[model samples]
Target: MSKTISFVLNGRQRSVQVDDPEMPLLYALRNDLGLHGPRFGCGLAQCGACTVHVEGKAVRSCTFPVAQAAGAKLLTLEGLGTPERPHALQKAFIEEQAVQCGYCI
Candidate 1:
């Protein structure tokens, strides 16, 4: 059964139809919404790669259920900043050359 899940993504209101309410939030964010900031490091949630902020708390979207994210505020890497106006951390990373493979960055 497909269900409509709504939430605040990157400071914008967004919604997606999920075939499984229990589907991982990562799928909804990446596949459904076309947001690729979060990567699929490990589906077991052991890795911090798929981490995203949910209601101001860090969550592993790979294991986080879409139903639980409904109506919550989500923040991914893309939400941090843009190329023209990068976030403070993003600017610092560039200046310091902290990013390597761009997986967790």
Candidate 2:
């Protein structure tokens, strides 16, 4: 059954029709919705690369099912900062030069 689930993504109200309840939110965000900030690293939820804020708490998007994200506010890397105005963490990362290779900051 293709069910439509609505949620707040990057501070924007968005919805997606999904058939499987076990489909991870990461795939839905990247493939379906086109939000690609979070990278895929260890789909088993071992890596922190797929970190995203779900209702003010960091969560592993790789394992987070889209069904669970329904009606919840999701803040990915895109939402935390922007090109014009970056977040404090982003600014700190730039200042400290903390990124090494594709760190998915």
Candidate 3:
């Protein structure tokens, strides 16, 4: 019952076979697409660990339905930058030495 769900991920066109369209986008990104940037902090979407950019706005991927992301653009921590070229935020975190469970570090 997996249906093809296509969307733009990290500035690239991507698709996945999602049997449950209602499945959280977090699971699809992590389990199916192998993106560990967004973590399942709280299933209730209370925590901010599973935060991602949808259409350039930060949204909780844990409670976001996979089907709802169709045709949308997504950006995870992985998309922000790489070790050789970390994003500005990553550089700020490094400069301030902020520590929070090392989720995005």
> Best candidate per lDDT, number?
1
Q: Write the per-residue lDDT of candidate 2 for residues 1-105, one digit (tens) a residue.
A: 799878999989999988997798888899888877888988888878888889999999899888998899999988988879999999999999896677554
TM-score attained by model 2: 0.91
Each model's lDDT comes to 0.92, 0.88, 0.91
For residue 75, give model 3's deviation from the true position in Å. 0.2
TM-score of each: 0.92, 0.91, 0.91
Candidate 1 whole-model C-alpha lDDT, 0 to 1 = 0.92
- Give residue 21's lDDT in candidate 2 (0 to 100): 72
Look at candidate 3 and tell me the lDDT of residue 41: 81
Question: What's the residue-level lDDT of 19 in candidate 1?
Answer: 86
Model 1 segments more than 4 A misplaced: 101-105
Q: How large an RMSD does model 2 have?
A: 1.6
Candidate 1 per-residue lDDT over residues 1-105, each given as its tens digit: 789999999999999998899999999999989987898997999978999999999999999999999999999999999899999999999999895776564
Which lDDT value does model 3 have at 16?
Answer: 90
Sort the predicted structures by lDDT, highest score first: 1, 3, 2
Clashing pairs in 3: none
